[model samples]
Target: MLSVESLSKSYGKKEIFKDISFSVQPGNIIGLVGENGAGKSTLLSILATLQSPEKGSIALFELDYKSKKREVRKHIAFVPQDIALWEDLTVEENMMFFEKLSWKKKGKEELKQLCSNVKLDRWNERVKTLSGGMKRKLNLAVSLIHDPELLLLDEPTAGIDLKSRKEIGNYLKKLALENGKMIIYTSHDMDEITNLCDQIICIGEDPFYQEILTETGKNILSF
Candidate 1:
């Protein structure tokens, strides 16, 4: 399980998060939702270990992110808000580079299988030549190549076509259901949150809310 306790951050005098707490179990999909500048990205960054919070801590399973940064990172994969890939590199080359950096070697068949699973089979094209949706797909493929236990996505479906959104959503759902990987995604799209997440954590300053939604109904709270 992933646990966040009283996570707080500040930029000079401006406070981003005051005291946030949440937990995500295996096979759970959590949505981080808020308006712009509501600290959604900051919170995700803290959870991803890209940055540290001024107060509080995060734990994946039994590993503490603060003390076991490297170990924690190995179990988590973060897809940033922007597409961070080498535009000059071919799609397959990008994936291969990331796979190698992950220090995990797979047979040729497994590598091909990973590409097919992410629907990047025809990825010989350069990343710069691919469409926005295709680039996002490749980004997700690279993040999952190491098979991290937790996947953190920051507005991954933003600015993509509807078809791509659905495809990515389905793939993430499959990973959680079939592979038992935990997923935490952040987005401002209410429909995406409603459809893809089992629980929603709403963050803001004046008013904050957190809700857990199931097929039947929702449990809501205000903070």
Candidate 2:
């Protein structure tokens, strides 16, 4: 489980968010939704342990963020809004490079399987030569090399075709239900969010609200 309490951040005198709190369970996908400049990306960065919050605390499976940052990172993977890959490298090459960088490296065959899981079959194709959808798929595949328990994605399917978006959405469901991976994703697509997430955390909205949705219905609570 992931727990966040009283989280807050600020840049100089401008405050981003404050007193934010939420928890994520295994086998659940939490959609972090908000309008532009709502600190969605900034919050993800803090959860990824790449940035520090001015207040509050975060923990994963009871491991405190301040005291066990490295351990926390090991169990989570962060995929940013921007693609993080070498455009010049082939699909297979990119997989191998990321694998080698992981603390738990896998064999070439295993690395290839990771890509296969995401349906990225263009092994020899350079990232620069692949379509936007294919590139997005490869980006996701690369992040699975370490097999983290949690995935943090920021607009992962943004600017992609419907087919690609559907494929990514389906795979994320598989990861959560079949593999028990916790996910926190951000997207502007309401249909995708409604279909993909088990709950919604809305930040930076007036009279702050967090809506928890299930198959039955949705409940809105003001914070």
lDDT (Cα atoms) of all candidates against the true structure? 0.82, 0.87
The TM-score that candidate 1 achieves is 0.92
Which portions of model 2 show Cα errors greater than 4 Å? 206-216, 219-223
Kindly list the per-residue Cα lDDT of model 1 for residues 1-223, writing each as its tens digit.
9998888899999988788888889998988877688888888888999999999888999899989999999889899879999999998788788878884676556767776776666668999998888888888888877789999999999999898888889989999999999999898777788888887777774342333333315432222
**lDDT at position 170, candidate 1:** 91
Pairs of residues at least 3 apart in sequence or in different chains that clash in candidate 2: none
Q: Listing every candidate in turn, what is its Cα RMSD in Å to the true structure after a full C-alpha superposition?
A: 2.6, 2.4
- Residues 1-223 of candidate 2 have per-residue lDDT tens digits of 9999999999999999999988999998988777789898999999999999999999999999999999988898898888899999999899988888886779989988888887888999999999999999998988888999989998999999999999999999999999999999989887798888887777776542333233325432222
Model 1 alpha-carbon drift over 4 Å, by segment: 206-223
